[model samples]
Target chain A: MLEVLAERFNYAVIIVLMMVGLYAVIATGNLVKRLVGLSIFQTSVFLLYISVSKVFGGAPPIFDYKDLAYDKLDPNAIYSNPLPHVLILTAIVVGVATLSVGLALVVRIREAYGSIEDDTLAEADYSLELEKGV
Target chain B: MSASDITQYFDYIFMAMLLCIGIAVIRLRNLFAVVMLTGAYSLISAAWFVSLDAVDVGFTEAAVGAGISTVLLLGAMLLTSREADKTSLGRHAAAAVVTIAAGAGLFYALGDMPVYGDAASPANTGVGMEYVDLTAEQIVIPNVVTAVLASYRGFDTMGEVFVVFAAGLGVALLIGLGGSKREED
Candidate 1:
């Protein structure tokens, strides 16, 4: 039981973090808070990917050539998987791009409605529906 | 203990910090403080990534997550209100239920996963190793991640670039490109 716990503890923590983000996204009425929650959620997923790629005794994926001159390369040198690193690097940038776009939308919504709360926006829509008789 | 043992402890500490920050962000009503906390969370995450042997990813996370994202959120906050409106307990409870359900489902699935840091696991044994091995001969770049990103999976990156470009265009269209022009008009 202890062994399993030790092995899976990181995943457990990540799940808790993810749930917190989800709660914020769903429960918060503020648009900026929702985006912050979304970012937390995204970062947790990145942690998960980076965690999966880890090798117990691995070095960073950068190749070291210092050993090449002294002797033949050590055949057993371990490296953490580079593929996920590459993917997540791109993802982090893309996450920011999407975040900026979301914030821009929030700014525009505030300009149009004069409030950034989802409930306020919903109330406005509800009154509009009453006026439209729909 | 050993260096790896110390790193493991660091991993636990950073993860604990991340959880605390997540809770703090949810609990804080002041958006400015919350945004700053999120940036701190990202910075800690980057440090954790370094311990996990993902230096390149850590560098990008520090730059994009901690730096650019925080700046963007603060700029957005300037145009919106500072304090978040209070949410009803009923909505909080409903959200908690949904979050707990999702978390429990993932927890159940977690049992089937390979142990953390098992090099022989499917993920570590596959083409990830192939890229690490082939980068020297095929691309001659010391950094395997860069080689695979720029050469092996160039198309995927091209798509990501397009997505980023589209997002920038959307932001500019929604809010004017020049900040001064918006204020002037």
Candidate 2:
């Protein structure tokens, strides 16, 4: 048990962060707070991907351009795998876009219904439905 | 202490800080403080990413997570109340149950993942190694991440860029430049 825990401590931490974010998204009533939760949750997954891409003794995945040698592997270098980083770069941008849209929606929601709380918003909509007999 | 041990210690410290801040965000009713803490959480996690040999991802995380999202969230908050509506105990309980179950499921499955930072891990061995080894030879770029994102996966990046553009257009259509005109009249 101890060995398993030690080997994957980072995973455990990531999982805890994920759960916190999930709880925030699920439990929070405020729209903005829920979005914050969603951001936290998205970044946790980002960290998880970064963690997977790490190389134990790896350097950052950039070359020192001054040394303009040609073909062979540099014995001193252990570059971190760049695939996950590439995927995450795209993901980070998309996450920002998603947050922007979500916040815009929240702004419009506040304008449309005087309140951003889910329960209050639902109540207002429900009362509107009742009044309309639909 | 050895260098790796020290690095691991820092990792643990940052993870602990993240965990604490996450709890604080959940516990606090003031939405403003929670928003700020969320940014701090992003900043710290970005640092963690740097330590994991993912400097490129770390840079993007710092930029997107800490900077842009914080500013946007704060902008949105200006249009809403600062205090959050507290959730009922039963609702929170249900959320906790779901979160725990999800956490436990991930935890159990984690052992199957390649150990952290093993270069010989499955992800690093086949196509990934091919990309790394061939990227410089064929592309002549100093940064493998840039080459892969811009050249190899150019289509995906283009799609993402368009997604961002579309999202901006959507936000503009939803809120307008001056924000719903306030309608004070």
Model 1 reaches an interface RMSD of 2.0
Winning candidate number (lDDT):
1
What TM-score does structure 2 among the candidates reach?
A: 0.94
- Name the candidate that leads on TM-score: 1
User: lDDT tens digits, residues B87-119, model 2?
Assistant: 999999999899999989998898887776677
Task: Identify the runs in model 2 with alpha carbons over 4 angstroms from their true place.
Answer: A69-76, B1-6, B179-185
Cα error, residue A19 of model 2, in Å, equals 0.1
- lDDT string for model 1 (B29-143, tens) is 9999999999999999999999999999999999999999999999999989899999999989999999999999998888777678888888889999999878776776678
Error of 1 at B16 (Å): 1.2
Residue lDDT tens for model 2, A1-134:
66666777788888899999999999989999999998889888988888878777688788767543555457467788889999988899889998899999998999999999999999999999999999
